[model samples]
Target: MAAQHFRVLARDPNTRARLGELHLAHGTVATPVFMPIATQGTVKMLTADDLEALGAQMLLANAYHLHLRPGETLIAQLGGLHRFMGWQRPILTDSGGFQVFSLSTLREVTDEGVRFRSHHDGTDHFLHPETSIRIQEALGSDIAMVFDDVVAYPCPREQAQAAMERSLRWAERCRKAHRRPDQLLFAITHGGVYADLRRWCTERLVAMDFPGYAIGGLSVGEPKEQMFGMVALSTELLPDDKPRYLMGVGTPADIARAVALGVDMFDCVLPTRLGRTGTAFTAQGRLNLRNARYATALEPLDPTCDCVTCRRYSRAYLRHLFKAGEATGPRLLTYHNLHFYLRLMDRLRAAIVAGTVHQIVDEMTRLFPDEPSEREA
Candidate 1:
């Protein structure tokens, strides 16, 4: 049913990279795309108009956060998340499994569901796989991820196997419970860095025949090589006709590498989060605007960036804004960082069409030479 919503148009000769399109209820989105995190229905310090201006194809929002705050019923009453957020493009709502699991000290996971205390008010709550599906359906996102059991990196083999099996069971529950025909439910594969477990999970999930698949339980403090290895295995096992999403992944280099491995969709909070902390992503590397060296620099944030922030504002002015604690400083940096990411996807897609995806990967590898840090990866 949901398979009719996506199609691959082109593929890279050298890699698994492909050019594709997601035909969603709201709008169409291109493959190898990076979705900006709009966790609370809005990207911090940015508006729907701003996101549109920045050329963001789709936004990633959290069902857990929105379910806790404002509630899903209210959003549905307000004409769903699209009208509620004033963004008419495609939106993907995470199953909230990660957020629930992140409260490790305050939560307990069982085959039935997860029982947890909200970080906001210490309130008690339970999220079943069925419950996650209902919440996402009420929110009315174009793509809804299945609720999965997420385990930390370096987890014991036995524990990883148990969690992976539980995630597959939950995926089955979500598939049966999802009722929104307009919204596509995606399955998430969880194997915690074990090649065999990853393959097992991927094979089983692919059999479920979801419209799309997301490689989850990664980018959670694992070594880059291990993460990529798992991703490679998962993507290889997943069906080529379906889109593969790498959840909560990555930097520019990470995106490039994942794209090469056959990932089609990605979402991360790095750009906005780093921007708020006075950091800017540039071709050369991350630039700390708080540094004294930038206080006298007159060039733009990234000389190659055509974003409004980079086109009009000088590095000295941006540093001054940050140093002076002006709110506009973070907004500008966030805009440009988003621009950089979206632009990177655009370039990759073009390369895929041009049969030169490796050129973009080479450029990204050169710009981001260091190994991915746990905090950012």
Candidate 2:
């Protein structure tokens, strides 16, 4: 049977901030949501159950890493990616384009696709748009991305424009090649700061008719203004019925600002990756669990948070675990950080639904205007 389709639930009275649902083969997802990075088909220390408990209805997986590690054929024979990963919720797989771009020596981009060396063992590999579609089909993700050329940070206008054009052409090829009706293919817009190129990509994709769209290659070491411009401009041009995803976006501040500008989905590695190094997100501000100031602190990670990390543990204990090289330290911090991000999304969704998204943004900024970066809760 065909799966259910995306539905618009609400829209902010004052802005483009919208509330919607993405129905997939696995389940439905709330819009304006943050997808935790499960790069290797796992969100670091989190299990599927943990994700559900935290209200996470979807997640993002990495094609390049999975292709290198487990090999695609194995996942296909093992009942596709769903059984291999044990995640029953909706999953989105990125085309290997961004990953190949990052591996400078190993990759060469052409009009057809990218040719590159495997980062794992210097093995040769090739990834084209149609090829990416085939791989994600084997992975059986609910949402798959088009293979796109990602310009490196600090690239020239002409270079960025060239990459965006390639990305748009690739997106058309991907949409035509895609075979899974159950899996939604989202085209990416890769214009760096060139509004004209961004508009071109958006206009082209809207014509190509992807089920959804993504704003890509923005936060690649560009200044905050450029990143926001990429998002705001792309969001302005995208169709209202489809979801707008901000690919590889940034910190809490970045998320808040992008959400305000009407982005519907976000995926980033900051929370889990930073958690391992003792960085955590709190309502007050960022916290480094390893800080000496937390040595004797007894407060919950965040006073208003109701997650397990806050409901049960203290800052001092978590600090001790991290200092003592215990695995529990990273686990606790990861849980707290993910919980915080997920909750932030929930609040934003609620605000959009309630016709008070702008008010929520104002209140959040006023309340957190800079949570004293203090060790105190």
Candidate 3:
């Protein structure tokens, strides 16, 4: 049997969407899955039990953060990320190339590797493809991403091409350096907003043939039309039998659109991030608990939601908590927001199977009135 395998169980006739299974070392992860971010080995404010309650099957962690903090060696000593975090399901770890470039200052990028100062302290650190693979292996995640040069949005075509070429070189090194047979190494496609360069990067990575693939370098301050165009082009070339992940993406509409383009996996911090700011996602649209409008509202955050927060509390009470500067406000909203995303994915998976993905997209459009205009291509 192959160490990593993806089998298509169903495909939508109208869209590129597919219902699939990702066979990994830890277990089988249902495709069209949403993996919440667990940056420091934990999905902030929510416990492992809370995750289980929400039916979360997988999560994403940052090897960069773990390696910088308690350290990957310590995590391995505690018996890998799964045991250390108490999450028995599949986990994917970013190679930290993005964080290094985005979060740190005084960085140098060469064909050999990237060197930058630690965001935690001012100390310098270097991360190359081989070192990234070693860090992920120590974490023992089910999936490890190749370290790639992620270029910022609106970059010059010349700079984009250079970044794409460098990413290709790094991917090859990661492919050769990855040692864990139990882990599936996935290559990331990078090329800013240039279609030709994006196509070139995808072709090169496909030739290298990593077990899985991720569409990176999107959602990086680019306009919606350009990002969707890139996603459409990237998905067109990626192998149908392998899982495709859209890294660090996005809103409900974003996920639905990517799924329509045949993406299988996603990870984002949007829900938790917004939840911390007293925002909640409802079927109608986003609701700000900080607003005085919800102060006397007796409705649940989302009448349709079955999450604990919705079942137990009202918008009035949640607004009161936030207005009063209570910590529980964020906690409750975070749980509900995660529940909303997971439930959205659940609906998407079902829609894929039912061959009604287009309908789901339209429904989400009506629900999020601001979305269609924003995602217009």
How do the residues 18-53 of candidate 3 rate in per-residue lDDT, one tens digit apiece? Answer: 999998877888889999889999888899999999
Task: Supply candidate 3's per-residue lDDT for 303.
Answer: 95
lDDT for 140 in candidate 3 is: 99
Off by over 4 Å in 3: 1-4, 369-377
Expressed as tens digits, the lDDT of each residue in 245-282 for candidate 1 is: 99888889889888988999998888899999899999
lDDT for each of the candidates? 0.90, 0.81, 0.89
Q: Compared with the true structure, what per-residue lDDT tens digits does model 2 show for residues 1-377?
A: 21236667888887778888888889878888899888888888888888888888788998878888797889999998888988788899988787787753557889988888876788888788888989899889998999999986788889989998888888889888998877888888877878888888789888887788888877677776766777888888887788889887656666666788988898888778778889888877778888899999999888899999999999999999999999988988888889988888888888887777777667556544532111000
Q: How many clashes (backbone N, Cα, C below 3 Å) per candidate?
A: 0, 0, 0
Error of 1 at 360 (Å): 1.6
The model with the greater TM-score, 1 or 3, is 1
The model with the greatest lDDT is 1
Index of the highest-TM-score prediction = 1
